[model samples]
Target: MRLSNTLLALGLTAVEATQFWHNTGTKSGWDAYTHEHKGTVDEVTDQVYKGSTALRMTQIHDSSYSGRYHSEAVKFNAYKKGDTGFYGFAFRLQDNWQFSPAQGYNLAQFITDFSDLNCGEDYMPSTMVWIDGDQLATRVKYGEVCPTDQQKIKSFDGLKKVTAGVWHRVEIQASWKSDNTGFFKLWYDGEKVVEAYNLPTNVGDGRPFQFRVGLYANAWHDHGYEGTQGTRQVWYDQIAAGDAFADAAPDKW
Candidate 1:
């Protein structure tokens, strides 16, 4: 009986070691999602994005995965052409990221794509702070649909350029300003890219919109949209919801 118990202990230790070896580089610390998404595993990457027990995305279909994380940062279309929601994260979107057309309420998003044409639009009352490969800039638009034609509420060009392949912090803070007014702000690498302010009239107060994060890959008008077609890998951790929008730091862990 003692021999059998010893063998079981050894087996358990071996399993743990194997798990640690696989997660060594990619994992920094445990996020609340790790425990909430306990059993689900990604079949592609074998990584998991677990949520807190109380706030699990289990209710949303196609919300979770059981494979490896995305290989390339691609375009994400969580809301349908007419759907609306809120989402925020710090990530790297290679030049290849693509944005879908603004059909109804659709907003195409691309990070790290510094070119003026490539940077897509967020919803009205939304703010995006992005570091182009060359410099840092914030895109704040106030209207629904593509706001490229509208005046930019705020723009910053003095920010430093964001290096590729390196991890940088980015975040978006959105709140309701009034029954039909919305406010949003953006930050890059702990610096404010856009200040707090009101959103566009068309967006009609951002209060009701929830947030979603994912990757999307779609063909672009020009075959030149090569980067937009492929999958891009992204790592997301320490996602939270509250009034105060702060970046996650090692000290906080």
Candidate 2:
């Protein structure tokens, strides 16, 4: 029996199991997380999913850059073509979150720099998760990155309502392909919310996309901030990515 167990352990290491990357947000540095925001990005121990720390992103209304307040954490070069990956994260909105009419608050995304193309678009995002008021939404972008108007965006709205002061899990499994053979799936709080097959989910060009998760007050930049809450905050923890569902699931890792 001892010999059999030894063989099994060796076999398990031969194949890559679910988790490829995981972050409990307990680290002191931001070496694994990158973002371009002049706002607050820090680690707090007041709340978390499974560890002693959680990443807190706070965005306040700024009149400096025409209401552009972005406080997000990104994992650069997270995905490429022909790669199937599952991403999972736990997030919590502030208890004082104000839910007004429809407004956009981006949560997570897969983006990359497209400035070399000289196509009027500098940075392009292929997949994104956001909140429309208190409702959760996501989308998958198709077509090439150029002109700023040629890309095809397939949006899935009203997945689940965001409950303030609570923890929610979001998981997405996607097949990155420039062709029409790719697929996209999303799960919210252990429930499958999105399933689409035979669809192109990325740009045709061969480039890696960076995955980001945080609070982007885009509505303030787009619609000029209509909500009553000026200071917005969100906590993120147990972020992971991998080839299998268990690898990225919150409870599994």
Candidate 3:
């Protein structure tokens, strides 16, 4: 069993937190936390990790416009600089997913809209988790908050290939900071894949960032579609964010 599931089975509650929050992706839960959601976002019973239902996000190939295929849920003011917290969720990619080479499918991200300033930076995402082909990848962007020229992205790729039709857990602990005092760590199914210390993890400004999880077919926009599967879908459950691992871990709640 995965560590999160193990914890739940053992009924462990050691970790403490400022807030213990969990979203089962029910109708009320989905409606309360998301806004400006595009494409198809629904609660389905076809597949679920812990609860009776899960959030299913679907995106189809849109040839009319060259925008992103985003069907993600957002939680505004989720975190800010100097805050150390854990965020986690359980997800499963669709079976028979086309694991084409060089195609990217975004899973979760932490971003905010900075378009009102009009300083060359619009909607910028600081951290993102995605799948490149069959392998899992994630990236962290730091330095200036605005303008692409002022940003620096550090990416960690080729962690592990995901298994379609099976549920997986992802947990992240981040110390949000713009200077060299922050740290970032990620655990996939209880194994630590990436750990970096004393690095810039967020924009220089102390603005709050939103945390979101869903399917964003970026390859369609960046490199155009390259696979037979044009439609994509993913399921998410036990979405949480808090200061302790138990607070965010799916099974722990």
Which candidate number maximizes lDDT? 3
> Positional deviation of 80 in candidate 2, in angstroms?
0.8
Model 2 gets an lDDT of: 0.78
Residue 22, candidate 3: C-alpha displacement in angstroms: 1.6
Q: In model 3, which runs have C-alpha deviations exceeding 4 angstroms? A: 1-17, 30-38
Q: TM-score for each prediction?
A: 0.40, 0.89, 0.89
* Cα lDDT of model 2 by residue, 22-138, tens digit: 677654323344433456778899888787899998887756667366687766657888888888899999988898766789888888889999988877878999999889999
* Alpha-carbon shift of residue 116 in model 3 (angstroms): 2.3
Q: How would you encode candidate 3's per-residue C-alpha lDDT over 1-253 as one tens digit per residue?
A: 0123332332222334343345776544332233122468788999999869898988888677677788887665667777788889999999988799879999999988888878987878889999988998998888885566888999999998888989999998898888899899998988899999999888887777778888888888889988788778999998887777777877777
Instruction: Please list the residue runs of candidate 2 whose C-alpha ends up more than 4 Å from where it truly belongs after superposition.
Output: 1-16, 27-38
Question: Which consecutive 10 residues in model 2 have the weakest lDDT in total?
Answer: 1-10
Across 3-50, the per-residue lDDT of candidate 1 in tens digits comes to 123322322111221111011112222221211122221212222233
lDDT of 3 at 62: 62
Q: For model 3, how many clashes?
A: 0
- The predicted structure with the larger lDDT, 2 or 3, is 3
**Each candidate: RMSD to true structure?**
15.5, 6.1, 6.0
